[model samples]
Target: MNLSDYLLAQDGHDWPSLLSDWAEVLPGDFIVWIVNRLGDLVVVLPDGSVHWLDVGNGSLKRVADNREHFVSAIDEGDNANEWLAIPLVDACVASGMALGAGQCYGFKVPPMLGGAYEVSNLEPTSLAVHYGLLGQIHRQTKDLPDGTQIKFVLSP
Candidate 1:
């Protein structure tokens, strides 16, 4: 896999180096390595879904259902300090998705507040909604949840 031109500038490191670093991780099983926000390791699965390896807990968290949604969410998200926007956009463009001013699509945030979930057992529709793609969703949060909200995109 090659890093998009836009992505190459975002992180300086090339695809080979990134892949090498990801392979060094224990129990390596990532198809495509994205970026590491702080200690959170972001990777892409064989099916094109995005996941984050929580180094602190030694767990993998679903970030997006697929690359498309991942790109859109990151591109539209706060990128001033978060350098993930360009990389995400590059990933999508590299995948051959035509994204620009009015081409990109957005999704609604998922119902689950925050925290990570099993990548294998995820609700695709919920993920789409969470990314702001589907119509508005109301969860009526009953209790005070823990941790920040996880932003998952893509349709399952």
Candidate 2:
């Protein structure tokens, strides 16, 4: 609803000072701090841009191309019994959606299906970059956010 509400929802991460200079570059009225826990932060701009604020390095990077793709990644992780916090990763699963198609490659046997695999390779797609950056951030901190939740209203 407002900045206080956003702060409360995000555990009061001092956003006013964090995002003060970017007022001209970022949307003003409807900024939402969607997630903040375990050192990860996510915010949704009014224009539907999803950004991941790297707490460790204090850098903000757009992790998803748009809200739709971010939501899709969340749903994919949910369906795979995984959580969508920061870094927006999909668990290693045997399905048409595994490894995000081109960003990764691996083999899966019968019982070993859906097991995690090395990211044999990477592409230039948002998904690949997200995965790569996520891995890089993860190397710094193995503890992921406590839970995954998307409270924004989905548009038609």
Candidate 3:
């Protein structure tokens, strides 16, 4: 089967189905999969890489920085199910696999539950900062394309 065939088999919001399809389609050397607090699916490659598949109810927007487009899906009022796709993410994973790299890790952030008006003891801002720090650490330690590093932040 060709790359197009693999891409065609994937569904945008179904995480498990998508993952299974990805594994069959690409069968890369390494696949580090993660299910975050917000139900977002993250896949990291052998080269210490990460990619976020937005499967949450959020608003997807393209942020322009340094002449490049960075896609972000933000969970906001009313429209909480918006989704975003990491462009060429699958290709990157397939390429890494073809290169014979092998190292995969999967992690999941615990879910946060509450009504819109309820304020939790944990500050959302602080949590964001903590995740941001973790993303930075991953990037510095892993050798991936520059644009790929920022992709983690936009993930769930």
Winning model by lDDT = 1
Q: How accurate locally is residue 17 in candidate 3, as Cα lDDT from 0 to 100? A: 37
Residue pairs with backbone atoms closer than 3 Å in model 3 (clashes): 57-80, 57-81, 58-80, 58-82
- Summarize candidate 1's per-residue lDDT along 1-156 as a digit string, tens digits: 333433222243344443343343323555546533222346777777877643323345676788777766665646312433344444444555543321222222222333232222122222112222211122223233556454546697
Better of 2 and 3 by lDDT: 2
lDDT of 3 at 20: 43
What tens-digit string does per-residue lDDT give for candidate 3 at 7-126?
Answer: 222223343433442342222643434333222444544554444443221111222221112122223332222222222223334444221111111123311111121112112222
Off by over 4 Å in 2: 1-8, 11-14, 17-30, 75-156
Ranking by lDDT: 1, 2, 3
- For model 3, the stretches where C-alpha displacement exceeds 4 angstroms are 1-18, 23-27, 55-156
**C-alpha RMSD of candidate 2:** 17.7
Looking at candidate 2, what is the lDDT of residue 113?
Answer: 21
Give the candidate order by descending TM-score.
Answer: 2, 1, 3
What's the lDDT of the predicted structure labeled candidate 3?
A: 0.30
Local distance difference test, candidate 1: 0.40
Highest-scoring model, TM-score: 2
Shift of residue 99 alpha carbon in model 2, Å: 34
lDDT-best of 1 and 3: 1
Q: At residue 49, give the lDDT of candidate 1.
A: 81
